[model samples]
Target: MSRPARAHLLSLDEWWESGEDREVRVELQEGVRIVAPRPRPAHARVVLSLATQLSDQLPPGFEVLIEVDVVIDPNTPATVRVPDLIVRSTTSVEFPITADQLALAIEVMSPGSRRTDRVTKSSEYAEAGIPHYWIVDEDLSVTALKLTPGGYVATGFVGDIVTSTPWPMRISLER
Candidate 1:
């Protein structure tokens, strides 16, 4: 049998206290601590490229937050997560955010992020009612998973170019 998953037992508040400590970034979900892999340059490049492309289309009132904390729930801390890119309609609050506060969450998938993006993070985004969730797969050269009640509905891939109005920003994702 496989070994049980390793998790840090801490509340969302505690995670915030040491958010940037660098040992690990912990997100509480269903009583489990998900320590995301350290971001690589490739991953950062994809996130920045996509953010820049989308930023140009954002309305004056909207703002794009890069690698920010988004609290998905007010009561239980189980759903708190930090998405790579978040498009918010307004600039409100400083840190430690709630899910309903965002319009869209974009996750750029690196080589090792398949399971997290497709499973854990996807579940959290949907359950929190995030209107749009983009899973940009560098491997497949596609953007998968449009948010739905059951799960992310498969949308067209970003082969050459992708045009989406997932939020206030009209984004184009291409290689």
Candidate 2:
């Protein structure tokens, strides 16, 4: 169910342990609450398809998840990013996975989320040391970004990117 927007500073523990049914998609931005609308059909489809493909090709220890909360920053007034998809370790049966467990964080850009995905999340994921990040635009243009000491750098590839970054697989950003 949706709730009226209000100011709530959420901690990592309160955010995870509070099991209230959060129907509206809410993400914590440095302890502040931000709500996002649900994804469109096309966005949802791409996420599911990518998850299926990734799951099929992933090694035993890694699994792909869709629209899950990731603890981007663990400090108080924490930041939790709900990425479109993530390739994380299956070893931990945790409710909300930390950035260290994540191998890749994927964001399917929406009309309202283009800037956040490309700039905001890109920097956040890099700062959290997520290793890899991918940005999928509405036109199915995929920008594969790898984390660097300087920042996140685009691999200069589009559509489909083949990688052995912890796992070997070919991910196609096609319909």
lDDT of 2 by residue, 1-175 (tens): 9989887778888877765445667888898777888887988899998998898999888888888888899888999989999998889767658898998899989899988898888888999999989888787777888888898878644677687765788877773
lDDT of each: 0.70, 0.84
Who wins the TM-score comparison?
Answer: 2
Candidate 1 stretches greater than 4 Å from native: 1-9, 148-151, 167-175
Writing each residue's lDDT as its tens digit, candidate 1 over 88-146 gives 87776655567877777888786777888888777878888887787878763555466
Worst 10 residues of 2 by lDDT: 16-25
Residue 124 lDDT in candidate 1? 75
Would you give me the overall lDDT of model 1? 0.70
RMSD of each: 4.2, 4.1
* Cα distance off (Å), candidate 2, residue 49: 0.8
What pairs collide in candidate 1? 71-97, 71-99
